[model samples]
Target: MFVLIWATFLLCVCAETGLSQKPRVKIPTLTEGQQATLTCVAPGLCSGSAPEITWTWRGAGGTESYITGSSTSFRTKTLTAFTQRHISTLTFNSSAEHHNTNVTCKIRFTGEKITEGGSTLKVNYVKEVNITGGTNVKEGETLNLTCSVESFPPSLIMWSKLGSDITLHNDTGSATLSIINATTGHSGQYVCTAKHMNNTLQENINITVIYIRTPQIIGNTIIKEGDVLNLTCSVESFPPSLIMWSKLGSDIILHNDTGSATLYIINGTTGHSGQYVCTAKHMNNTLQENINITVMYIRTPQITGNTIIKEGDVLNLTCSVESFPPAVIMWRDLSSKTNSKDTGAYTDLQNDSGSATLVIQNVTAEDSGQYTCTATHPDTTVTSSVSVIVSWFSKIQDVSECVLQAEVLTCVCISEGFPLPTIKWPLLGNHKEYAIKTTVSNHTVNSTVSLKVKNHGNSTVECVSNNEKGEAKKNLMIRSVSDTVADSSVLNVGYLEIIIAFLIGVVLSAVVCCLIKKCSRKKTKNSGNLDETLEMVTSQDDPQVFMFIWLFFFFLHNYKVFNCAQISSLLKYTYLVFWFSI
Candidate 1:
């Protein structure tokens, strides 16, 4: 009997504990501030009378409490079947504090028997979205971004760039976004999203890259004189790098700006040529580029040697100019009709520093004129000139002839020379009055000298013509005063003979008149009365014959003093008196 009773007790325990399914509790995870429902199902719980069912709660800290009717709701349902099933539900508003909390359902029978079923409350909620990472990163480096959600239900987190629909990272409660070899293109606003149940939260952060690349310099390296020089410096960076331009060896900064800078040099010269550098500064690092600039220039030529050279002497000249890219030197004679280089009389020697020497052998008067030295460069030509002069002389001419008229004596002399010769009469005496006349035509001089010969008759006169080169002279003799006196005596004797002949003729005419008058009176006395004829002959002959003879002698002696017309008039008067007496 004892063995049968023990077996019966074991079968009853197996039927109550193992043979039936345990009461089930089902609860859903919910976001904060949302309504939640807990369901409890007990099958085969109907006995002879109705059983009591109650609900209770347990906190995550192991505390327990019976649920009241004010903030909680309980509902029960029975199914009509041979084996009855009973269902109970507990409802409440969920919160972060309700996470991991437990809700229990209990049933008590009439004999003081009890059964219970419980479920843990999982509240899917997040209090805030938290992000922790660096926003600034260098180029070509690694970028790390992490996002965490501080919530009870372990919210889903996702990382995405702003204005993009694709997700970069996705995980539960936390997520990390990593980028390898980050560049400037990776810089922008990023969005981190936390999602739980029906709630979604987002946070934004900006990312930037700070890095500098090699700087670029833009301009022509080779430049001409007087041209404007322009150059630009450029760089690529995230933080907007500082750009600066400067010479390679100098500390002076040419330009400075933000991202790009420009350097301008107006009217550049040879002094502006050098090495230039462009530097970019970013994030405590610097990058640079070097450029070489060359300037081409030239200056006016200068002549430094003697210009005046003597005949049959050597001529030397030096020409120089200051220039870059050394100039070509040449010597030219502007007065020469032909090219100077082709003439063998000139020699040219040139150097690399734009200097040259010109040599001429045995210079003559034909080489006198303007000579030029020319320095030529690729951009310009310069020249300088010098004038040369030569001095010389010519020969003098000889004296020609001498002439004499009355008391005046004249002599002529001539000379031919360059720069004109001077002619003079050197032997003119103080007592003798003289005049000298000189003239020049076609570089030839002619001189005439006249002197009054008074008592000094046999004097010698000299004509001298001279110049800086040489001198010449001639002498002439004058006739004596005795020879001139002898000629005058012959002329006086001829005049005396003419006067004696005239006087004799006058005396004979008077004698003829007296005879004719005496004969006429004798004839008249024979023909008529002698007293009337004698009276007529007396009135005609006596005083008229004597007056006519006296007048003829006066005119004949003074014939040399009076003219031919006066002598002829006196002779006619004497003839008229003689005819009247007859």
Candidate 2:
């Protein structure tokens, strides 16, 4: 009983002492490079309890430790959670990264419970780090780096770039260091440090940022129509770049020599003259560049000339022009002389550069005029001229023998001369009835004249041919028809004989008819009067005797009929006869 009472008295004293002193919780022991936590617990403290807790540092190098919340001189920094919490906690991952660190916990109790503790960390695991991905990155690209190490219960991970701290995404076993939308400024070596349970590991990755995808010039930038043209297409890439030539906006191959991003053009033409671009591909990135090409060709040709020409002279014409495939030569005469009205002769020659020539044969005075030579090619036409001169006109020769009336007349003269000749009658004044006629041949252009005159005494007539140079005349004779009729006569002696015969016949017939009629009448009357008829006969006896005498004379001379000139002689003869007969 005496020993129990003595223990009770000792316990009471100890309790009082505990209440007077600040309570401190024991900080756990931690290994180097390992994650750990130091807790300061005041046992039996309620939510209303207020305590002042402080953390102190004790270095592993045997230096003096740092303290806070006490009047003691120390090199220590008080953490934020320790200033107000009655139970203080230092939550951290223990690693080799902190192998030389020392930690201490102190508390000032506002209530009855208080605790104080201190600890030192010692790292143990072998430190290692691994950078799983490449260190190099492109500008404006995603940057991801994984840092991992063999650790227990995971590790505390950190990322840094060029000496700057960077946020890290950490999982249970690995940590990833990343930069979203990184640029050229973000290019450098990156370090990933991981702290595991009492172990520390680090990984350093070298990054060489490069511009692998670059602009390129693809295919031939300059091309021609007929021949090959060289084009240069250059690009920058990690490997060789892919360059191609295409028409505007199309994917079809524009050139054949597709090289490994270099200058190449197999066969080029105007069709290949368009936009060409190059595609530079590296990894998953691509770039492009463009170029343009144009084609050229030759133009057409031209010609010129004159229009007037002469007969006996040289004719010269020309045709000249320009073209792509070299111009062709042609000479055509668009005139009646050449016979070709439209298209002309084509003269093909090796020397087709400038102009072609056309010549005419020996010319005449009739040919003295303009001659046109037309030169025509594929797309154009031109004209030229030739001049000629001649000496004189053509020739003509011939005449016909002609007959004219019995009058002054002229013969036609047909002949040829240089400038043509005129004709006239030379004997015009000698015969008034003579006239002349002149005619010209339509086809021969020769002049001929015929002359005529009166048939008086002229024996011949003359025709003259004259011109500016000289004159020649020819003669023709004429006969007269009126001179033969001037000395002709006729006589009439048969008319007297026919008249005497007719008068005798008429007188005999009349006497016979009268005697017959008178005898018939007397016979009828004397039948009754014979005596009266005897007396009438005796009285007529004297008339009968006279008739007898006249009859005898008419018979002796035979009855004659005479004209008026014989009538007087006949009467005188009648009276002499009467006397003679008596």
lDDT of each: 0.69, 0.50
The clash numbers for all candidates, in the given order, read 0, 41
Across residues 131-225, which tens digit of lDDT does each residue of candidate 2 receive? 78766767678887887775544677777765766554555467776677876666677777787765667777877555554564544444445
TM-score for all models, in order of appearance: 0.51, 0.30
User: Model 1 Cα RMSD, Å?
Assistant: 19.6
Best-performing candidate as measured by lDDT: 1
Q: 1-582, model 1: which lDDT tens digit per residue?
A: 996676566545533642245567878766668787777766453423455667888876677885433153344444433224566677777787777777887766456667788877777667788888999998889999999998866788999999999999999989999999998889999999999777899999999977777888888877899898898888977678888889988889889999999999999988889899988888789888898888888778888766765556777778888787788888877665454645535433334358888777887656666777777888677777787653234444434455555565666676665446787676674644455555568667766665656555556666676767566666655433343443332121235445554554556566776556565443344654455444334445356666766776576547644334334434554455445544
